[model samples]
Target: MASSVSAAAKASAAFAHKKELAAAAPAPTQHRAGSGRRSKPCRVRAVASPARAPRAPSSTGSVKTAMTMTEKILARASERAGLEPGENVWVDVDVLMTHDVCGPGTIGIFKKEFGGDAKVWDREKVVIIPDHYIFTSDERANRNVDILRDFCMEQNIKYFYDIKDLSNFKANPDYKGVCHVALAQEGHCRPGEVLLGTDSHTCNAGAFGQFATGIGNTDAGFVLGTGKALLKVPPTIRFVLDGEMPPYLLAKDLILQIIGEISVSGATYKSMEFVGSTVESLNMEERMTLCNMVIEAGGKNGVVPADETTFKYLEGKTSVDYEPVYSDAQARFFSDYRFDVSKLEPVVAKPHSPDNRALARECKDVKIDRVYIGSCTGGKTEDFLAAAKVFLASGKKVKVPTFLVPATQKVWMDLYSLPVPGSGGKTCSQIFEEAGCDTPASPSCGACLGGPRDTYARMNEPMVCVSTTNRNFPGRMGHKEGQIYLASPYTAAASALTGYVTDPRDFLM
Candidate 1:
């Protein structure tokens, strides 16, 4: 069985790398009409029928109202001429997603309210993925996935990513790990669309220039019965990030800095709109990382205006056409904050809170027992590449245990395939192996949410750990007494080498 799993992983790695290489080629040029603005929104040709396409902003009289991207998306989804902040509106849902942890409960609610015999409004638009607790011996955890499988089969859901074999993840080719990453990878995320999931990090999809947020089970049930949801338009808080990103700073640091500036509840019930040269410079995955933790800062959703980079990432990922929107030049903002990326340094959130920020260098004396590199926030292909770069540069074996969990199967494959730039020809997997780190485990949301007691890499003891995952609340990763320092992949890897909270610049420089 072990041999078969190994062989399957190897074969898939080779095949996945070929596709990655093809995708690495330069994207086609996207022409744009310059409006003399600092940021120009990319015009997307709508492929959906006229009814499905959002109505263009009205241009009837001399007076016109400016709308932010969040307001514009809500207006289109609700079929309104215009909308204002704090207004309750019934909006059309582009996609409804549920997963193992919440799927069973959401399913129960849907049946209770809509009747078991009633069919979903749109089977094609609902996405179900089982990721949270797939790799465990706990019966209840395993049963949760079974519930999702039966529900998906009964509903005839078109986009259900399921896994039946717990022993060998490679056996389940249909299964994609981690709900947030899987959603984007499977092409369910598109620009100018409304996406609601049972998970809070659903806001991660907003990075694609969409209105994506989390909804309760009851709200999800309502959307299940009818393809519409009653939502309130949130006021916009504009964050302008300028200057080139420093070598040591990743999107994780930028977001950590933002959260530290504004307390966890600072942006409560408001849309956080990220703009400016620095934001535009980020790739899709980096943008996703930036938006993923907005819920921690009490944000409604986070959006980056769609441009060439956004179009490039979605090229082969989706066949459905989407209309990307942007904030009007005169858009009203509840508040505006500006940041200079060049001035920022690598930072981490101390244990027990995502807002407890501190510089990496400040925590150098803090010893760590383990270093974790995975989660929707830091477990992408590029994230692993960054960690590998650090490890290769350090040229030292880890002094502490370093656990690796890829967010999805594709990432798992990439670890074994994608070569690290400037590392000769070494892949991330090879670098990790040489660094004395644990072999990258099967892709899943392992230990991020502190699943079943038997979960791999669970913090069973009261030890300090440097982790790339988000959230460091009490017992977030496992033991209540465990201390977790939330950090970027580079910092996590550097800490692993020294068994202390070391800054990546120590090695990178």
Candidate 2:
């Protein structure tokens, strides 16, 4: 890794410290997550049955006559009645996904709770993806997959992405990406659908305009036997991001700022309905990044209203016909906040918490030892494209050790062949390889969780890193001593190049 910045960058003083700018500012929102507001029981709107509740006119302020995305999707899944906030209804699940880390435990609970002879509620709806900890050298990890595989065979579950890809990396075309991405790839996640997964990031699928959320093992076991889950319609909090993001800004930054503003638990148990032109402008991948982190804000789910971009991503990629639901104009929000995207700076969540954030430029000089640029949160073609653009401009390699994960095999295939924006005849992986970095072929959730011993990029030594992956909770990526700073893929790349935390704008042309 290079030890110094390019001559052009040194002269720019992009990392110059400004104490005033670094100071944390008073929050600009009313419901800031951990801002010491008096704890209050979740605001429960009075329960109303579908028969009694009528669709409100667009101009009406009555929530009873309106429906938020969560209410609409849950009501349909209920199949028996309409749903409103605070109403606990048994909603049928469209799909249920579990990865290796949680699958074995979930299966155990299923058998213990439903009896040994009971089979999965619907074999076709259960999708298994052995991702987290699958690559570990531990026999226990491999055995977990064996357990899942055996169960799938016995139950006739077909939507299973096994450890097939680990053999040749490109061996299995059926080995979809991460559980969340694979779900979307296979069309299991769709607008107006209700999906559940053991992964908290399952909310990532909510970008498709669905009511997707994470569940615990007990809930998974229950759903396994019944294909139904009990969920109270969550009140929706709308974030209307206005204005256009600057060229250097990305969705990761926008989300970090939101979490930073709201505190990690700011939106606890509420549906985050992201609306605004800026949100509409984000591509499907970016929108997914937005929803993926809502859990960080203590949200029940995160969603963007399905639009052209959402459909364009699913067109031809999925055979499942889907219905798209939109929040009624009269849908009432628990609380609303508007942020001008153009005014938002690239932000990073500091160590130990997702909401302990600050402007990336303000912390530009903080030295880093590691950089990671892939995870379900930041690993995508668009994310790699942003990183490649920065690397191409610097005409340099990374100064710190960096890892590039492609989120899935399909994404890796694209990076393996994608030409760097301006680099002469070089692929994305080639650019990183040339910069004295490593690009692993097989993609899975690596280091995002401090996985088993054999997990690649697992932090063994105490080192500071700027990563594109979500969450910075202590020990989230690896060793508890290893501090993590969360930023955009662009920031990850820029920081890798400079050996210090950096604002991507420093390298943007």
Candidate 3:
């Protein structure tokens, strides 16, 4: 597990010295690989389809008109660009992202389909980031990354090798982890843009108010070769949350409660919109965590109507000045869902599935062996503070093993500056260090996705483990034989203190 970070450091250093030169180089109008057939320039459009004519009223005298965010974007893209849902329309992509596990696959496909003999559709529209398998603990993983590095150089890909910081390798400056998080900080992802990546969590970009989604390796290959894809417009489901969240609750619980209601597949092939008072109150980090896991519930992507929270996080990070965009006042949705945080309690998802959720109180007596407090989902700053606060208030040490991992280098970089509730709020990481918690700041896929660190040593422990990761599938974290529960950061922390499946409400009360 540690080797992944080590390998990444080496890769980062090798690539660090070239950032200045790369940045200074003028943007190329032609493909670096010199593949594919060069074609005429194509015009870009926001909406690809036109609005449908109004339908005639039925005998009931009521007309129906509703559309989802995904539908609206695709419809608009199609109408304005003259593209049908299934038609392969070649266009410039706003952002292109690929990682190690899939980057080589995409690169290979690109070479085979369009290399040397043909001209690429667009070169400036691509980005390559190595994650998922940054560390090569095995011969195969090492070879995979080597192939990727070579291919990137050949293609002149603007690669973030080994999560390097252009020139400041020692300062680290938080450029080590998942592609989405890296892209967010590097200004590759922006609002009102379309992004496609080779990873499922590519939807993570929705946090930036962009139309981002994931596709399979084959799909990515096609897009890499032709800069075009066929898309099926998705329906949108709206969530209007009102009221305030108590100390024990936050965005993770809100999403869990939703999964409990909608089931894992309830929102299949649909886009989800998280809005209203509750959403507005959430900081950008919290919103990002929520939106990052929307796909786990089988939705195309999760989004929020851009507001102050969104603007504040993106102000200086984007290439262009921020211009907020929101759903039209008359924007249509397939169905509307509402949540009241004031009345909500801690929610947990049972193991082997994310949809098997129940209130924490429903299973208070369950025993726990391990507690994890990080992942791309709940490993952000807000999550750390919430968990540390509970531990500090109780002045208790976790009786069971607990693991805390920061999603990206940036997260760890800020962990020491977090303000505690009182005493003007001490850094949560300091408190965690004092509390005897194993809080290590490392890259993505650490424990939640079984990347190698802190794996389960025994099977059938029957211990109730609490985690903040997106899914709780069989053997997801460490072992299939061990029992696992998914909860908000507060809930996981509360359980950590008690060494039993405990309700976070107890600490708050």
- What TM-score, computed on C-alpha atoms, does each candidate reach? 0.89, 0.87, 0.80
Question: Across residues 39-119, which tens digit of lDDT does each residue of candidate 1 receive?
Answer: 334453221221212344354332344577898899889887667888999999999999999888988999999898878
For residue 292, give model 1's deviation from the true position in Å: 0.5
Please provide, for model 3 over 55-167, each residue's C-alpha lDDT reduced to its tens digit, 9 standing for 90 to 100: 54464354433333444355444444222223333333566788777877877787787765544455666777665654435556556767766766666665454543323
Q: In model 3, what lDDT does residue 259 have?
A: 71
Predictions in order: lDDT:
0.84, 0.78, 0.65
Q: Which regions of candidate 3 are displaced past 4 Å?
A: 1-68, 75-92, 116-124, 159-175, 321-325, 423-425, 452-463
User: Residue 122 lDDT in model 3?
Assistant: 59
Better candidate by lDDT, 2 or 3:
2
What digit string (tens of lDDT, one per residue) describes model 2 on residues 60-171? Answer: 5454445666887887788633456778899889999998989999999999999988999888889999877666668888899889989898899979887644556577
The candidate that achieves the highest lDDT relative to the unseen native structure: 1
Question: How many clashing pairs does model 3 include?
Answer: 21
What would the TM-score be for candidate 3 when compared with the true structure?
0.80
Q: List the candidates ranked by TM-score, beginning with the highest.
A: 1, 2, 3
**lDDT, model 1:** 0.84
Which ten-residue region of model 2 has the weakest summed lDDT?
A: 3-12
lDDT of 2 at 26: 21
- For candidate 2, give the lDDT of residue 251: 91
